[model samples]
Target: MEEFEFITQSADETSILAKRLSEKLTRRDVVTLEGDLGAGKTTFTKALAAGLGIKRNVNSPTFTIIKEYTDGRLPLYHMDVYRLEDADEDLGFDEYFHGEGVSVIEWAHLIEDQLPNERLDIKINYINDSTRKIIITPYGSHYVDLCKELRDESISH
Candidate 1:
């Protein structure tokens, strides 16, 4: 698997990377976020939502599990699967995975079996109070191309 590594020196840099990623996303795209507590997963999601043209404030749906935002160019399905570690009940995840929106999942490993085979996996590591290391891995051809484009764009900037 190919991986892209990006080091963000500040929250603004992280947001910039998230927004750039969001620009390439389309409906049915799945992005998984993994990191420790307070690693800026929700902060990155908010920036992604903004890139999608969503005006509403995007927050982690920790209690609700899934939050849908439709004001964007494409609907945004934000999911937090951290609490589903023990539950075996199917939450009809296929519906959202195949839905007409981009799904961004936090703590996705908790429901790894329910996730689609093709998706982008992102791991964020806290480097300092304001710095972070983001690693992106693509699982399918579409995502591979997307990452390549993102890499090219980043290089040109």
Candidate 2:
């Protein structure tokens, strides 16, 4: 469970990072995005969708709780758990976890307990108006390989 730091110079960079991460995605994967307001969670998710071959518009599912986008190669279960007030809100969390798609949750800190044990944790920290410090932590072998590939590219470039 080691963490790797990725610095993003712009929103586009964050999006590119998301796209690259999504390139290696398959079914039953959980990606938990953590950040403050305007930290680019939605931006990253949109990039992920684009990478997954989704042609639909991607937005913050804040009001809807869960947004499903199947236009992509695989199901993209975009979830925003910010609306949950109940600490024990299990509301359809299993649908993404136990389902056939990959789930990416925004404001996942709200429903930390509902997440799977082996997943990817992506955190975005705004360093300024246009800069972000992104950290990726892998909880299993899949993500560990992701981090390794990311690290290799980082080292090469």
Candidate 3:
């Protein structure tokens, strides 16, 4: 496991970074996004969905809890657990985590106990109105390799 940091100067830059990361993702890959309100969590997810070949609109599933988009190369299971903090229910998250799709969870800390052992955790820090500091931590060998590839990609560009 390792950590990688990137500084994005604008929303477009952040989207580009997320798109690059999405390209290397495979089915069953889990990515957790940690950030405060208006911290670009949903923005990154939209960029990721676009990279996955999704043509439809991507939005935060705040009230719905989970939204599934199957038009992409692999299904995209977008989950927002912000409202789950006080609830006690099995959302069958394992099905999405292990399913034939990539899973991105927002406000993942709310359901930390249900997350798999291997996943990527990304913390977004707002540096300014449009800039962001993205800190990515890989939790397993697969994600470690993903981070290495992302680093190499960044270096090349």
Candidate 4:
């Protein structure tokens, strides 16, 4: 398990960071978002959608549970499992995880048993009205490389 930390002073900064990350994403990638309400999970997803070239609006899927955006460079599977209490619900996660797009799961901890072995886990901590501390953990080599690349780029700048 490898980790990287980033502190954003504002929501715009968080969006910029997420855009930088989205540029590195590829097909079949799974990214989990864990945080409290209003911690910027959907905000990050919106930024990611922009980076993926998705023109549609990205909103919290609290009621829909899952939303698919296909206009991007690759498909974007955005899921909000906040309402789920068990992993027994058959939401057909396999198609999304192994599909031609990337999956972004919010409140992922609730479905821990269903997640793939290799993926990226991100936790957002609210610091103030506009600040947030994001902790990113890579569960496999692919995500590790992604973090390394981001870290190097941040250091170079």
Could you tell me the TM-score of candidate 1?
0.97
Candidate 2: residue 99 Cα off by (Å)? 1.5
Candidate 1 local lDDT, 1-157, one digit each (tens): 9999888999999999999999999999999999999999999999999999999999999999999999999999999988875657799878999999999999998888888999999999999999999999999999999999988988888
In model 2, what are the clashing residue pairs, if there are any? none
lDDT, candidate 4, 70-124, per-residue tens = 9999899999998986667878987899999999999998888889999999999
> Following a full C-alpha superposition, what root-mean-square deviation does model 2 have from the true structure?
1.1
Tell me the spans in candidate 1 whose CA falls farther than 4 Å from its real position. Answer: none
Ranking by lDDT: 3, 1, 4, 2
RMSD of 1: 0.9
Per-model TM against the reference: 0.97, 0.95, 0.97, 0.97
Which tens-of-lDDT digit does each residue in 9-41 have in candidate 2?
Answer: 999888888888888888999999999999999
Model 2: lDDT of residue 107: 83
Model 1 residue 32 CA deviation (Å) reads: 0.3
What Cα-based lDDT does every candidate model obtain? 0.94, 0.89, 0.95, 0.93
